[model samples]
Target: MRTGLLLTTLALGLSTTALPASAETLHLFGPFKDEHGATAPIKGSASAMLDTTKNTLTYRFEDNGLSGPVTAAHLHGPAADGQDAGVLAPIDGPYTTRMTGTLQLTPEQVKEVQAGQSYINLHTEKYPDGEARAQLTTDLTGHKHHME
Candidate 1:
C-alpha cells in the first residue's frame, strides 16, 4: 500500500510540472485622430494573448475610417505613450481594416511588453507615419489594456 501511494504522488508531481503556464489576455483599443498625432480619422481596437511559456504572442487588430488603404502595421516599443520607438515586430499587411498574426518574441521583447512599453501602429498610404496607434498597459487588476 505504501509503495502504491508513493507512485501516485510521483505521478501527480510529474503531471503538474508538465502543465502549461496560464496565458495573459491583453485588451487594446484606440480612437484615431489628428490630436494624438495621426493625420487621419482612423479608429480601431485590438487584443492579444501572450503565452509566456511558449514565448509566443497572438493578436487580432481591426480598424476603420482610414484615410487610405493600410500599407503597413507594426509593434513598436520600449517607449511610452506620446513617444515613438522603432519597430520591434512587423505585421504582414495589405490590410484594409483588419490584420491578425502570431510572433515569437525574445526574452527582452517579452519583458518590454509586460512593462507596458509596447504599442501597435497601423500605417496607411496617406499617413506613412501612422494612421492609428495605441499603447499596451495593465490595469489595477493586472488585466492588460490597450489605451489610445
Candidate 2:
C-alpha cells in the first residue's frame, strides 16, 4: 500500500510539472445529439488554453465519427442551451470536419469565458447547417481530464 501511494504521488508530481498549472489544458467534450430539435450524431473533443497574461485563447479541435460530410465548423458565444446564435472561430477546410486555430480574445471576451460564455459547433452535409455543438465553461476545479 505504501509503495502504491508513493508511485501515485510521484506520477502526479511529474505530470504536474510537465503540464504546469498555469499552462494546464481545459478538456472539452460534447456529443452533438441534435440541432433544431432533430436527431444527429456529432462527437468531438477539443483542448482549450487560455493565456491570462495575453488574454488569448488557443484551440485545437477535431470532430470525426460524424454522421455525414463536414461543411463548416466554428467557435461561438455563450448560450444556456447549445445553439448557433454565437460564432467565434471559423474552421478552414472543405469537406473536412477537423479544426485548429487560435483566437485572440479581447478583455470582454476573456470576461465572457470566465463567465462561462463560449461554445464549439460543427456543420455537416446531411444537416447542411449545424449538427453538433458544445459550450466551454471555465474550469477552476481542474477535474476535467484530457478527452479520451
Candidate 3:
C-alpha cells in the first residue's frame, strides 16, 4: 500500500519537498466495461493526469480483447452515468491496444471532467459506435472527487 501510494505520488509530479496541499494535479482513472450498451468482448483500463492549472490532461490508456482494431477513440461526455453524449475531444493514438496523448481542455471540458461527467470511448470495426468504455470518475490524489 505504501509503495502504491508513493508510486502514485511520483507519477503525479508530487514531491515530498513541496508544501502540503499543493495538489494542482488530479488523477482520473477507471477500467473499461461492457456496460452503457457496449456489446463487444473488450476489457481495458484508462488513466489520466489532469493538470488543472494548465487545463491539460495527459492520458494513458490500454485495452484488450477488443472485437476489432480501434477505428476511433475519444473523450465523450458532459453526460451522466449510463447516458451517452457526443465526443468532446479525440484521443490521439496509434489506435492499438495501448495509447497515450495529451489533450488541452477547454474551460467547459475542464469543468465537466472535474465533475466526473467524462468517459473514454473506443470505437472499433465490429462496433463502430463503441467497443468498450471507461469513465474517469475521480481524483486519486484525493484533491477533489472520489470514485464510487
Q: Write the per-residue lDDT of candidate 3 for residues 51-88, one digit (tens) a residue.
A: 77678888887788887788989999998756889998
Residue pair clashes in candidate 2: 75-88
Clashing residue pairs, backbone N/CA/C < 3 A, model 3: none
Ranking by TM-score: 3, 1, 2
TM-score of 2: 0.62
C-alpha TM-score for every candidate:
0.71, 0.62, 0.74
Lowest lDDT 10-residue stretch of candidate 3? 139-148
Using TM-score as the measure, name the better of candidate 1 and candidate 2. Answer: 1
The residue-by-residue lDDT of candidate 2 on 44-91, one tens digit each, is 556677665467777666666666777777767756545456666565
Error of 1 at 56 (Å): 1.4
Question: What would the per-residue lDDT of candidate 1 be over residues 1-148, giving only the tens digit for each residue?
Answer: 9999999999999988876676455544333333245555556666666666666667777677777777888888999877889998988766757667897888788878777787788777677888677666654343333432
- Per-residue error for 96 in candidate 3, Å, reads 1.4
lDDT sort, best first:
3, 1, 2
Choose the strongest candidate by lDDT: 3
